[model samples]
Target chain A: MTINFDNAATTFPKPVSVANAIFKAVKQYGGNAGRGGHKLTLLTSEKVFDTRQTAADFFGAQTENVIFTVNCTHALNFAIQGIMSNGGHIIISGIEHNSSARPVYALAKKKKCTFSIAEVSDDPDETVNNFRSLINHNTKAIVCTIAGNVTGQIMPYKEIGKLCQEKNICFIADGAQACGTLDIKMSDGINILCTAGHKGLYGPTGTGLLISDGKYHITPLIQGGTGSSSLNLEHPDILPDGMESGTLNVIGIIALKNGIEFVRDMGTAKIFKHEDKLCRQFINGLSDTRTIIYRSPGVEYVPIVSFNIPDMKPEDVAEKLDQQGFCLRAGLHCSPLAHYSMGTTDGTVRFAPSVFNNENQVESLVKTIKKIQKI
Target chain B: MNMTAVSMPSVTLAIKAKRMLNEQGFKCTVKRAANVSENGCTHMIVVNGAPEIVIAFLDKYNIAYGKLLGDAMPQ
Candidate 1:
């Protein structure tokens, strides 16, 4: 079997429970969720509701506050676009994923919204201070990525969240690479928590979440049938129902439920320990003279490491590794901001280990990297 | 009990108020505020109970709500 190290992009080989949960949901409850009152539909809706509650509890939120979306991008859009639907100012971190940056820039162009980027530093205090300095009266929200996907750099989002709280600015966190692997609490001044079910959470793709702490105004991105308030043509003025327009991804959501269960049972601390151990092992094994690792790890981060070889493109190294039967993601990893922040403008080869990865795989990857760099 | 209407500054708070009241065995229905119809924003939580009971729940939950306008129509 090929060694998979691209956990940051999308986790591979999801927990058996996740797969089984999807199978069960599809086999037993194939009816469309929130569409009707039939037994099948009710059963489907019940599972969906249970999953929604599970996600909310896991994220320290309320059941009514949790809304599932297509992926982290969609969730982020719901938080970013919805909050700044009209013209408003927002503060974003410089190392944010495109999921955080693109939407704001799009709104700036389309909705006349403005945003300021808060530069990051290895010191969490410095980062927090930067974010604080950037905040102003007009700043309605602060959209931050929990960690940089490319560099595995963790931001002091909690500290920044507190700043947002003191200023009454909404905190919209992009937990794509951090959720399920990191200890995230919504009470830490996080208003809207958006995360991907496929990455870190070990669920199938096409599933994501936006959990609120009952403290923010998020204008619905899409307004359509919410399976509630059918009498009124206008979208019902509620939380999840107001934001959730169309039918949700039921099967994927059920799988996400099982994924959250796995994470909860195994405990995020334990999973993170295992993944971080493997990451450090691989980091220590890189003896190649041509290899260069980026960003000094200071704060807590997920098990993602980005490194590069001199005079070689990130994609080229990834292609060579692919030839050797190892799956890894190289290039920008969809975060030009991260690359520009770390001065890895050409991008870097990223290795993100998951719970399924072991020492043998890390050894193989490290050895292969050394071998490739010597050529 | 005269059906009382409770207005909120935003939809999120209105939904929270509705949820908190329901958990306390209060039957509260949510509808858009009549004055803000043209904007299609802001909502009110309608409860058949006294406004004091509703305000107490909103305060207990730390959710902000306002007195329904004397002239505002109840849904």
Candidate 2:
């Protein structure tokens, strides 16, 4: 079987507990949460609350502040658009994924708001200063990715959060690539945090989280039945319920609780250590000078590394690697801004390690790449 | 039997109220609200404890509720 290394996109081979939880959820927890007061509905609602509480505790947020989304993109859309609804200035990092970029761009296109891109530098302070320089009187919020999806460069999110707090601007962080590997919390000055459950959390697809500190009111993106104030035509103002209209994804959510438990049991530091070791092995194992690794010396990164071979299309290299029983993501990875920022506009093959990957796999991948280079 | 029913805006808050009251030995259970107003239906946490004590607890926690209904008062 081919080893899976494209974990930055989504983790494969989910934890046994998560799989079991999914099975249990599909069989027993199928009732729509907060939809009715029946035993099944109430039981399911309680289970959903359990997951919400777990996420809240994990992120140091209140239980009501935890909102389940279909994916990280959905959460980013809710946060970015909600915060930008009043038509004001917003700042975003240069390395943001399309999730944050597209929503902000749409709002700007409709003339609902205006935005400025903050240039990220190898120096964390410089990155924060760039964001600060873009702030004006109308600056409402700053949307940033905790880590670059392609290059794995860890942004100064906490420092940026501090800047936002000092300036009274809302800080919205996309933690799709950082959550399970990095120790993050609402207390880290993040007013809002968006993340995917399928990635580092080891959950199944179609599960994400939007955690808030309850300091700001976000306009709901979709309004419908929330099982609260059923008589009124107007939507309920209650949290989580207000943001989470329609039926909740109980199966994905119950399974996500187990996924988070698995991450917690293993510990973020340990997971990072394991993945980072594999990344280091992959970087060090590549003895071929023709390999161009997209990384800087002083900057920190998650476990992802982007590389390209000279005079070769990244797609060709990825296909070659795939034939050799290895899986890696090639092309822009849906973050053209990241490629533009890293000066890799032509795209590159990304090697993203998960906790399941090991040094042997890294060694084999390096060997495969070396062989591919000769062609 | 004397009982106090505290109406909550949503099931989540009703559950929260039940958990908070039960943890303090208040012995409460959540049920669908008996009286639905024009505003809509909601959930209620029924507690067989002193109404003032229950009200005080909910107030202390700042848990939002719709109304306080009871079959009997301490007076």
Candidate 3:
């Protein structure tokens, strides 16, 4: 049996309901969303709208605040670009994925905008303080990833959110790696949240979402036929219609709706407890000889781990595990800056478990890693 | 000779250069060096051709990077 451990990238083997929803969407209600007055199109639009409501409730956000996108990258781009014009300053964390890093860096270069990167710390309080130190009068926004994609570290969001609120700085969160996996309260002070429907939410690829309290508005990255405002050449200046241009990924949206419902049925508390137990069990089984690298303390972490065997390249270890029918992500995982910060320039193998993973699979993974370590 | 210039921020510029070289039927390899000015890592592409033609394509696509001169080209 194939032991998949790359749930952080995208969760695989989705629940039966997710698949059923996608199939039903494609077979029965395949139509452009919010485009035509036809019955089928309206039905598709309603299904998509229902999904938005589900996401809003799941994350403790307002219904109209949620906007669908192609993926987490698209959602992040809309939020970052929309909030700041040229020549503005923003704050970001050191442990950000390329999706966040690249866009911010590009904007910094093109617009000559200044950005400060806060350091990552083991203590949650220190982490919050690091962010506070970086803030200044020119700092227009603060962007953070709820969980580090590289180390599975959870940041001090509650404190940071309150700080942003007190200072009136925009707080944007990249929730791609930590949506359904972690419980996020909207009242906690986060202004904008960008997430992936495919990751912890257990939906297929090509689905993402962005949530805002409507305090900050951004121009759409791509403006074209949104199927509304057919008469005007200019883009519609409204909530989702402004940002959501072109044909919607209808099938993916329907599947994501069902996926969110599945999470609701399971309950976020129960899901977190199950994943935490599994992760702690896996960490306990590792011997002292294994170097477990992570940041952030006390707060719960996503079910992910990055480690390296002494005197061996991470790629070689990953290849050996692949030969044994175990799937894992090797190398920097598209975040070289993160690797540089962790001092793992050679990169580390990342193993991320999910709700679909069983304890037996964890035991087998441990045994496989041990056998490979001997070699 | 039409001279076009493209300025890539980092990393992605290297990937774009390699891809463009391959598409135009040229062999290319990406090289890495520590950029002291940037205080971080920087990468450049070593391609076998006239620099002007490469620069034009890169400029059209708005790919950002710098030019290599003298011994900077990989042997």
Q: Report the number of the highest-TM-score candidate.
A: 2
Q: Which stretches of candidate 1 lie over 4 Å from their true place?
A: A297-299, B1-75
**TM-score of chain A, model number 3:** 0.96
Off by over 4 Å in 2: B71-75
What digit string (tens of lDDT, one per residue) describes model 1 on residues A57-160?
88888777888888999999889988887678999998888888999999988867989999888889988999899878789999989888987777788888
On residues A1-375, what C-alpha lDDT tens digit does candidate 2 reach at each position?
Answer: 699999999998899999999899889987888876678888888898888888998999888889999999999999999888788999999999999998999999999999999999999999999999999999999999999998999999999999999999999999999999999999999999999999999999999999999998898989999887888889987887889998888899999999998898899999999999999888887744589999999999998999999999999999999998899999999999888877788899999999988888888888889888762
Worst 10 residues of 2 chain A by lDDT: A280-289
If you assessed candidate 2 against the hidden native complex, which CAPRI class would it receive? medium
Please tell me how candidate 3 rates in CAPRI terms.
Answer: incorrect
Chain A TM-score, cand. 2 = 0.99
Candidate 3, chain B, TM-score (2 decimals): 0.67
lDDT of candidate model 3 versus the reference? 0.76
Best by lDDT: 2
Query: What is candidate 3's CA lDDT for residue A121?
Result: 81
Second chain TM-score, each model: 0.77, 0.82, 0.67
TM-score of each: 0.84, 0.96, 0.81
> Model 1: which docking level applies?
incorrect
For lDDT, candidate 1 versus 3, the one ahead is: 1
Backbone collisions counted per model? 0, 0, 4
Q: Between the candidate structures 1 and 2, which one is better when assessed by TM-score?
A: 2
